[model samples]
Target: MAQVEMNRSVQTRPWFRQITPAQWQALLASSLGWMLDAMDVMLYSMVLVYLMSDLHMDKSMGGFLATLTLLSSALGGLIFGILADKFGRTRSLMISIIVYSVFTALCGFSQTVTQLAILRTFLGLGMGGEWVAGAALITESWPAEHRGKAMGIVQGSWAIGYALAAVVSGLLIPLFGWRGVFFFGIVPALVTFLIRKGTKEPEIWEARKNTRSDTEKEGSVIKIFDRKVVRWTILGSALSICAQFGYWGLFTWIPSYLATSVSQGGAGLSIVKQTGWIVIMQVGAWLGYVAFGLLADKIGRKATFILFFGLAAILVPFYGFTHDATRLLLLGPLVAFFGSGYFSGFGAVLAELFPTSIRATGQGFCYNFGRALAATAPFIVGTLAKSMGLGAAFSITAISFGIAAILVILFLPETKGRELT
Candidate 1:
């Protein structure tokens, strides 16, 4: 009875109290990086239709540009992961911020799809690295027990970043057009500089590197593929691939889908309403992210993944096929919640899968590698949309989520309370 009461009380206690000051600061730093990265990357998605008209491009071409960004990000994350493992996570994080920010601003000046594509590919480099650096930093700082929650909070920032883009686009697009949205991407660079001056490297990482010889500290991409780490890497990559493909396939077109006229296979809503709906749906997403962390910390990682993946599988199709604005408004949040929330678990689960020696490298490869493969999703969805309609195009995401659920159940182990070695 005493133990039961103790467990109940602990459950009732707020999760934030368990985190340390330094951990909190690390969370703040990483969350800001992710949030800003989301703002920069999604800015393009928010304005893609306007861009299509201005650049005289089709959905497939726009999706291809998005694909280029994802593809380049794979290399960027892999490279930066090596650098983070070798040099430091904080430094890599800052440099990534600068790279993405500068190029995102440059995207505002693009005259053609070719120009935008080039600038976006360059921006993808920094954009991918931001997650690698930030996730590594936060994962290394927080305790094992709190890792899931910490990652959830950090991943929750993606919604914040998405919301920031929506808010800024809603306000700015009317005044300065899509170009102004891209110009705002440059603002995060200043944030990177401040975080550079303010934060230090995780001591665990420092100790691990300090004990090793200069030669020993060198990072190798091939090491993640060795016998010991390869299995987990494959599993993690599969999950990441499904999540990325499903997410981008559905969301890259949501704004346009919401705003497009009924004749062209959309809701025919105005830009303001579409932006408002997107923002509102993200509230559900934010709740999902928060809930995943808490529940993963409580129930266990495997169950959490299975639960959300299943929910996403069901909702993605419902969302895609539903046409009534009223019904969509109702289903949208639940769809966003389940579809986006499972992401909170990825960084924490992957961080625990490998030791410090190859942590960054493994994570970079797995997360971005899946992203690289998933790069084709947007293009595939776009091409399909030509004949099947946008709603039908998104049903493919349900299949991706279904695969992720199966992989999680069949192969992935529970890392709920496992300490990071």
Candidate 2:
């Protein structure tokens, strides 16, 4: 009897590890895909100045292109979310990677502003799809006990991608020009092969496929809004939109805000100094992502979001006010810590709120749709800066964070420790 009990315990040991090798492989693959997705998307922002000058496009055109990308991403998420649910996660992820990579490379070849805008729109679709499939796959496969960590790690990939884009743009833009930097974006397409070779369908999704009949499966993706789930969908979408508005509105302009001449109502930091500031701030963002996961797991998701976003609302305005480089350097991390930390909770919360049949669809709709709405951030902030000054323009982002805190408190349900289908 002792031997029998020992054997049972041994048999269960594999299930009890924080993250099994298979789970880690899934996380790595998903994270890499997401990282590349971010790299491809962010490449545009990093090189926007060069593109605008080379192509002779004005700020409105640049803002319009950014808006187009966001709108396309919403459509991509909706389409791919349904595909991920109906097909397999691995397949959807592979397709998304391929689509984005091909289009991103194509952007390097564009001769006109119209061509670049069109290419970016399509690229946005693939970019949007990768996250929905990857997030859903990771969330479903990871055990509930460690789900926060898994999503945290996955969410953290965005910072890595952003950092990579900055490094590549800084190095290659000097050597190969902005077009050459875009050409390099093609390298991420190689990641698709890794997915095809390394990943299998998650056990949960595979089991669902085997157990559920076609007729019994959930109906159209629109059914996500049926009587039982629409409220959560609306709440999740509002929170996500608010977050995106806050992030894109402020961070996208930091370099411009810093580097523009003082006569133009800017801080007048040099290019090298601006890059250093941007990179350093991301370090704080990285910590925020990891810390938010651990804190949410301990104190609950709602409390953690409120803490970070509330602090962000307070810190963002202060970050805008300081002109001293030393003070700016010191405050950058704190602003990022509060401003960027709450993002990790979205994966865990969305996963918990939706069931398997529509999980990806729900996640995609809430996130990508919100992104589409908030895509106006760049344009709005730019217009505001043009008229009211950059400092005042950025202060609006703080209000968005404040709004996110309120939404989470009033509407979002706690999702910690909830098992996924």
Overall local distance difference test of candidate 2: 0.84
Residue clash pairs of candidate 2: none
- Tens-place lDDT per residue, model 1, 1-421, is 9999987887577767766688788888899999999999999889988999999999899889999999999999999999999999999999999999999999999998888989999999998999999999999998788888888898889998998898899999999999998999999988876687677799889999889876774558888888998999999999999999999898888887887788888888888888888998888988899899999999999999999999999998888888888888889889989999999998899998988988999889999999999999999999999898898899999999999999999999988889888
Candidate 1 lDDT for residue 317 = 87
TM-scores, each model vs. reference: 0.96, 0.94
> How many steric overlaps are in each model, in order?
0, 0
lDDT string for model 2 (281-382, tens) is: 778887888888888888889999999999999999998877667787889888877888788888889989988888888999999989899889878887
Candidate of highest TM-score: 1
Off by over 4 Å in 2: 1-17, 217-219
Question: For residue 26, what is the lDDT in candidate 1?
Answer: 86
